[model samples]
Target chain A: MKIAKDIKELKDAISKFSGSVGFVPTMGALHQGHLSLIQKARAENDNVVVSIFVNPTQFLPGEDLDKYPRREEADKKICEVAGVDILFMPEISSMYHSDEVKLKAPSYLGYILEGNRRPGHFDGVVQIVMKLLNLVQPDRAYFGKKDAQQLVILQKMAKDLFLPYEIVPVETVREDDGLALSSRNVYLSAEERERALSISRALKAASRLIMAGEFSSEVIEAKMSEIMKDIDVEYIAIVDRDFRPLKKVKIQNSIILVAAKVGKTRLIDNLWV
Target chain B: MKIAKDIKELKDAISKFSGSVGFVPTMGALHQGHLSLIQKARAENDNVVVSIFVNPTQFLPGEDLDKYPRREEADKKICEVAGVDILFMPEISSMYHSDEVKLKAPSYLGYILEGNRRPGHFDGVVQIVMKLLNLVQPDRAYFGKKDAQQLVILQKMAKDLFLPYEIVPVETVREDDGLALSSRNVYLSAEERERALSISRALKAASRLIMAGEFSSEVIEAKMSEIMKDIDVEYIAIVDRDFRPLKKVKIQNSIILVAAKVGKTRLIDNLWV
Candidate 1:
């Protein structure tokens, strides 16, 4: 496993590798969910490259940027075990310059849901993703469905910019108790961890209601919001595949999402029906 | 020369050509300036691609978009004589989609001079240029230094986006009367044509002043503005190569630019020292 700390080193490593390349970009603190993505890339492509960058621009002030989880040695071990060929770890200085032109996330789509909660978040995501995508030039990239909107926007970027690659979306990994896998999960204390499961529980309730012919978006959201009564819910939304809000859930085209603050830690969960 | 009307066709031509590609994007109505670019591209690159797109996004409402000069037959003849390998004539609809992500010119640099007078102009220019660049996939693209800010900003975009192509800047082609070549010059009547020479003459005067050890930017700008007294001068300013206003000319780093409305036609001209 080669470790590349800069773009030149990464490019040299990529040149050494022959055949198809698969890439996975992460914010470090790898868990089973990230490992799953790496493993899939390793299996599908002749070479797998994983980038661990804790992007500062994505986090607004007062957001958990400074304290965001970082397990460098463990992450390296995980990548090595998952058969990653190249591990790109860039410093903040190497990846960005002063007053550079940046990618702005499309205003209409990006200003809703997670984007609203973390304003300017996706713009930073798109900016870094664009840089990473161009540098890696992978045949396919792996993104976990845990960040559904991010995955969708990255897909849109690829298509919009005519980037030559494919986005392979792995299903969201979950804990036995139904809590979605997230690096932020480390922020939860025992009691907070228990309370955090309410997010998944609410999403499960929505899924069940949908399975039982409850297609009305308002009723499902109302029921989900009721179940999320223990926490400070930011939003309960039912959006179409394009993210436009719909009055009724159209099967195979709808996603029910919820965002809530569980003891000061924001948790988001959703199910596609 | 082969004619391409869509991305697929353009990329097809691009794929077959392995050597360096030189590109010139225009809005038809082939003039001496465009011919100069085509001739230079032909002389330098293994293949030459020219795009004639009367980009709608770049034109404001009531800005003569409908009556923009487009002499297709003459354009083809000019390119053929200039040895262009491929001529790409794309429809505006073919290049852009509804509700798409867009490029914004730098807020600080874009909203001055030409941008202030014609807001959103550079955004549209950057937007179309990006699409054309992507479609062309040229090893090197050419832009005349006449559109100095546009050229500089495009270079910034290429660097910011990690676009792996060189921006080859050619000199601005001018007439015997010192008027910079422009398609919009067609909109100038005979009297306005005589007045339009004021832009180039002011730029030349600024060049002469700076060369005579006049270091103060304010002094140089005042001299240039005085020369364009008859024209409705929008702005006469001195900026560094990065488009930031400079207090004093830093020899080789200073740029004196002038924009004026001569009759109904707006003209921009600049000199980089």
Candidate 2:
């Protein structure tokens, strides 16, 4: 209900809370996925803080940073309706300085899937998350499983850096058509929206293949590739919970991740099997 | 003092404390400088935690990491005497992972002066410090100003990353003869020890110049250099609090830093003017 536009106000607002704090950090234009994270946080903690920062550092030079969706009034209404104790919307200038310490994602794991497509993207993610975590100092921080690679990297960072908070991953939220909800979904044209469904369809097909005892990564990936033959598939990887490549899927520990361009808007989705 | 050798143990030990914690992170040589930091921490907070980690990442390949002083017993006694509540000494394996998130010090500020002499050194410093700070989660973390550049870099990191704790800058402790107390001073032979005193002596000469109304940085650095002519002076820099090069000494806001080698040992010292 309380909106904090700066660091000092946020700190002051957070300091008044005596119980455990749960945080959900997101870029603006609250989607169903973000709402799920906030709802989870709301249910889990005495104080729920939501930060909507479209961090510039996370976007590469050619990335759609400028065009990123901003629905501040709507986001505020969503947070209020969701019972968020505090909503933090900090200016970019306040969050970052010209020359400051930066974080580098793990050399091997960071540069693989999403990182390969968008170099230095995870670095920016790690940097902003670190700042947000430090500022919020939440008991538990909610991150959706939709950004599987990001979730894994953040978990690794939290452990490696000795961050004293739990990274609670909420299940990915999907539409009735099995399409994962993303803010970037707004960028899709009417026809492109229909094509984007193929991504989830491919993932569903991979799931069915795995359910039918096709554990071989190559076979599943081949089938997944076939499912989205018309779409621009960037990669379809089978990796363990830790993001290490697996030749064969290990049920309950494996994730089939897919990334593709649907009409110039890159989308990523994964299924935990 | 309770000695915690693992993360879980340290966390449990820290969890029992309900008061403010002040921390001093060191590499366990128990020198006067370190003692001063621990003493300051003890004085400032309800609980004091000291960590003795000879972080290998901070040391370059050819640098003296293995031979770095590790007087565990003596350091323990010093911490106990200094009223430290907990002393955490974690194994290298426990503190770091093979492939994990790493910190990069600001490109420009990190790669200059001492950073220039030892590339990637500040990165390691920031990385380990970040880990230790997160693990301890102290109210205040203490650092001696003897390593002026390091102090500045860490302060920048704390502000930039929005670390919740305060970085307390403690005054540098020195021997009666004016040698800045350092673990590396152990490597100095009797003859080499005498030569190392010139580092502090040069700083003193510069101070005397400043006191005598000689504000020109170039003139003061030239004098300081002349005083340490016998030693291999790595650099003689006069910079502002933020590490920006100063044309003339800005009273109450400038630092004169010195680094030199005596025999095979590298030593650094600085003066806050």
Candidate 3:
């Protein structure tokens, strides 16, 4: 696989490819979730491009940006083994500049759930995603459903900005224990890892409630909250596909979300019914 | 020229053209300045696409949004004569949606001079321009230099976003009497028209001062102020190309800008030395 370490090299490599390009953007330390996205891209397009840049703007002041995982050697090996045509690894300086244009997420939708906990996080996310989309010019971009809100916000941004690419939403890759995979999962201690299972358990409980024709969000939220009561639960929300609050869940259109802190690490999971 | 009144039509027409596309996005009030931009686009690329959408996001609540000029028939004729291949005229609903992501201008460069006079104006400009640029996906995009700061800001945004198109900065078109051409010039009455001449005249005087080796902005601004004393001058600013204030003119890198109100109409002009 060809590697581009700078913008010029990436642009040159991208220019040489005329076929449909499938892109998967990640922040290094490739996990099974990222591998699933890359594998989907590899299967769908003539050229598959994967980018690994731990964007600093997406992290708030007190966020875990400095301690974010970075395993470049392992990530490169995984991309090559996955048959990625090009791997773009740009420096932060090439990606951002001081006193430049900034993006703002939607006020109402962007300020709920994860956004409420991390204000201005979606703005940074939309900004970096936009820059990467423009640079990649992919025919299709793959994103896992693990970051449900992020996926929805990115899909909205692509439509609102008139970007000409399809956003392929892949299902969240989970462990054998039903724990949703995440890069931050590495931050969990042994006991915390065991506790993190509560998140998925809560989501599964909600899914079961929905499957049994119990669409009342209040009852489902109560049960989910009870399941996650052992941890430091932040919120349990039932919303539509657009992130609008729904008092009662609409099957196939509803999303049941949960965010909580397992020990010191924060974790989130959702079930799209 | 083919007219596309919706996004689907525009995309269909754009997809059929396989050559280099040069785009000119306007607000449907074609003047000499816009014609000049179209002419340059025609000269450079095999295909020329012109969009005439009076973007509502770019206009403030009290701005001239409702009263903005709309001469679609005339604009169509002008584009046909100018050899434009595609004319995209999408509805506001087609271009934007409720509670979606938005773009923000830089706090430092985008909030001075014009941005100061009209807050959040550049934010709107950047947002709409980004949408239009992404939709057009042209090989080159053209903008008149009369809106110097707007051009600079757009260039910065395109670069910052890594958009794959060249921003061709066309010189501002002027009349024989030295007034910069603008669609909004029609808002001026006979007397207001005559008074508005002070803007260009003051710029000319500043140019002469620079020619005569007057480098200090304080000395030059004082003289220009004297020339525009009769008008309701809002501001007389001398700054670098990046919109930062300069103590003295840097010859090739300086810009002298003026904004004034004449009988309820606001006008702006600038000279790039």
Q: Considering every candidate listed, which one attains the maximal TM-score?
A: 2
How far in Å is the alpha carbon of A44 misplaced in model 2?
Answer: 0.3
Residue B219 CA error for candidate 1 (Å)? 4.3
Quote each prediction's TM-score: 0.92, 0.98, 0.97
Q: What share of the true interface contacts does each candidate keep?
A: 0.34, 0.99, 0.92
What is the C-alpha local distance difference test score of candidate 3? 0.90
**Where does the lowest 10-residue lDDT sum fall in candidate 3 chain A?**
A102-111
| TM-score comparison, 1 vs 2, better candidate | 2
| lDDT per residue as tens, model 1, A84-121 | 99999999988886666667777867778999888999
Worst 10 residues of 2 chain A by lDDT: A222-231
Query: Candidate 1 residues B6-116, lDDT tens each?
Result: 878888877888778899888899999888888888888899999999999999888989988879999999898888989999777778765666677878667777788
RMSD of each: 2.5, 1.3, 1.5
- Put down candidate 2 lDDT per residue, A1-273, tens digits, no spaces: 789999999999998999999999999899889999999998999999999999988899988898899898999999999999999999999999988899999998789989988899999999999999999999999999999999999999999998989999999999999889999999989899899999999899988988898899999999889888888999999999988899999988999999999989999999998
Q: Write the per-residue lDDT of candidate 3 for residues A183-208, one digit (tens) a residue.
A: 99999998999988989998998888
Off by over 4 Å in 2: none
- Selected candidate, larger DockQ, 2 vs 3: 2
